[model samples]
Target: MARLLYELCGIEDALRFSPFCWRIRYALAHKGLEAETRPWRFTEKEALAFARHDKVPVLVDGDEVVTDSYNIMRYLDHHYPEAPLLGEGMAETRARFFNHYAERTLAPAILRIIMKDLLCAIHPADRAYFRRNREKRLGCTLEAFHAPAQGLDQLNAALEPLRGQLKTSPFLDGQAPAGADYLLFGHFMWARCASNADLLAESDPVHDWHARMLDLHGGLGRNARRIRDVGAV
Candidate 1:
């Protein structure tokens, strides 16, 4: 394949569950592009040295190398220019805002609720490294950082903005999904692949949007490999 995507995974090479990677995966499917996915783990930074970046979701399109989820999305849309991820005019600007919202607001909130669950889902080789680095960043041990009884209240509170938006339309981008929808979907996909806990109420509009995301592009996101308890439906 001329195009390849290196993604974060657990013990099983098929169990790719990186939120950033999921964004790229969804973007690729949205553009009707096919790229072979390569599984990478946290302890394997050396594997990505060729890209000069220490992260997963690295896109290798022949000689072109792109890192970071947002950048990768832009690269795909720029290079392909067929099925656009962000529409013209101010659409790109609006998508960028939602991308920032997902990375800054949504991701941190989801991490708090699933940090411990994520630890259990990583490769065994990555356990010590992940724990040490994350604990230092969080200023507490994983076990000590519980998000308070089910963490649903905190998660729901963080999702209020999305809930409100969903009530107005079927997706973040008025009539149909665009970059903003994929941006936020990545985090929910992360939780679905890494944890067993139900993060949304059945009646929540955000939950409904998630279901629609899962069903997009012939269920590309829905068919991904997840942990046993939270496997993709």
Candidate 2:
């Protein structure tokens, strides 16, 4: 049986916008594996009941079912040892640090920039649930976070370290792209597919790196559907 990957999508099935899901998508490509994409939506909890998980990025590989993007990456590396996601030597250790940085630093910053846009990108069936839960997490209404200039400024500031790193190396792991690169690029993919917010400036190293990333895996990301075209970089 062919492998299957269930990922979060918006109004269009092609608009797969989950940051975590995007990580695994690129990881799968890096490993030279092609899984059928199952476009899942925000209100599709019941659809995932078979996995006993309410989240997307669920992978079905033959008899094995995997939940969580990080775990799925580990699964791919473990099963397909030829193409590695985590780099060799001490690179895995360094990549772990970048992974943590993406989770602890970059994701939240990007969320602030695209929170409102995200809500609109989702299916009408999911709007109420999405707003209620996200608003609860922020302790304020979704509108408060929508296009906040301060939030965009914070996002640019948060990306400074990445810009500095890219200045010295082509990829996050120096010479080659690693798990860390995929992990962070997923967030940018989220912004790209869900919103038209100009999150990157032309001269920014991060922007250049993102362009290179989009070109990888045969333009898997660059060709994705953008639900809205409110702004451009």
lDDT per residue, candidate 2, 138-233, as tens digits?
788888766557767888888988888898998886787868889899889998998878888898888889998999989988987787543332
As for candidate 2, its clashing pairs are none
lDDT of 1 by residue, 1-233 (tens): 89999999986788777889999999999888999989999989999999999998999999999999988988888899987887657988788888888887877778878887788889889999999997898799887776735456667777888888888899887787878889889988898888777778788888889999999999988888778744532
Per-model TM-score on C-alpha atoms = 0.93, 0.92
Could you tell me the C-alpha RMSD of candidate 1 in Å? 2.5
Q: Give the TM-score comparing model 2 with the true structure, all chains together.
A: 0.92
Candidate 1 segments whose C-alpha is farther than 4 A from its true place: 87-89, 148-150, 229-233
Whole-model alpha-carbon lDDT for candidate 1: 0.85
lDDT of each: 0.85, 0.84
Query: Candidate 1's error at 17, in angstroms?
Result: 1.1
